[model samples]
Target: MGQLSRLAGTVRPGGRTARVRAAVLEATQDELVEHGFHGLTMDQVAARAGVGKTTVYRRWGSRAGLVVDLMNELANQSMPHADTGGIEGDLRANALSVLGALTDGRLGATFQAVVAAATCDEQAAEALRAFHLRRLEEWVGVVDLAVKRGELPEGTHAAEMIRAISAPLYYRLVVTREPVTPAVAERSVVRTLAAARAGAFVEPVE
Candidate 1:
């Protein structure tokens, strides 16, 4: 699966520890995509990974612990903010990246599983929160650069602007159950950019 490769951390020759971690994470993602978080179990993950149950438990402690590490790995692999010499292009690039991940079969299912789990699981929710927070921080750089270039307001909240670009796409993906297409992603960037240019994202002076 395309998602499996992304979840598999980099490997090194003779790196047994890295290999074990990669196997466990790959198995964890496969289980999440097929069975979801509610159905996920440490034993199943261990069995699927071909690692000992004791090794799984000793390393992850519990299903939530596994999810936390998995989320962190995914976050670390996220692409850095695009710089296309203009905010619009960068925002469109960002929006399309979100659309691509949410539309991907295995990756999308994995995220949906985590999101559903987060609805009632505090640990899952925290993991999801941290994952998005890291992504948001990474992409906010484009907005900050745009402001410095006089393309956006002087005090535009970079993080807020970046969030605005992705919010509508996510709403369609999770809330409205609507199709998240390239057109939709483009519209989000356009609307968010227009608002940012109008100072809608500017932080209020206290």
Candidate 2:
């Protein structure tokens, strides 16, 4: 989703500008992990980043802008779709990737803070929405490959297949407040592939 990039009012830059963005976003995440969205402030980020407050305000405009760019940066840094030569292996890799991210201390805390903020803040909600959508789009390619290889139903919904693999893990992490163990991630892959083989993810003709 390019919505957040548009909201930030700039495309990716280079040289000094890129450095400034990197510093400011790092500061933003540090603040989010320690103080959360409510406690985050433009002035504090500027100070933490060692940049001028005016520069921070001019570049990002608001706390939401900083978060938008940070999420974009993370998305850019995320691993691409796995190619393990089969649907099962690829989906297993996807599940493990989700597990790693959710279990990572700093990254997990950053996401939790944003998810909490999204409930009450429209801008934060947009950032969170954009982040997940970008990830989903990137991972959909693996499903496409599986279909071409006849490993899945011809009309299977690729995005749905990807979502199914992660949804249970997220439910455990955010809803049930239970541990999202590797076993849980493995179960998701096994179950989703079974359902997929049974045509559970096929799209209906309107």
What ranges in model 1 sit over 4 Å off? 1-5
Report lDDT (Cα) of residue 191, candidate 2: 97
Tens-digit lDDT string for candidate 2 (1-206): 11121112333566778778877888898899899989999999999989999999998999988888888787777778888899899999999998888877777778888888888989889888888888999889989898999999889999988999989987887778899999999999999999999999999989
Question: Candidate 2 vs. truth: CA RMSD?
Answer: 4.6
Q: Per-residue CA lDDT of candidate 1, range 1-206, in tens?
A: 01233555455567788888888988998999999999999999999989999999999999999999898888877777787999989998898888888898878888888998999999999999999899888888888888899999899998888788888877887789999999998988888888888889999999
Lowest summed-lDDT stretch of 10 residues in model 1?
A: 1-10
Determine the backbone clash count of candidate 1: 0
Give the Å error, residue 24, model 2.
0.5
Error of 2 at 80 (Å): 0.6
Which candidate number would show the highest lDDT if scored against the true structure? 1
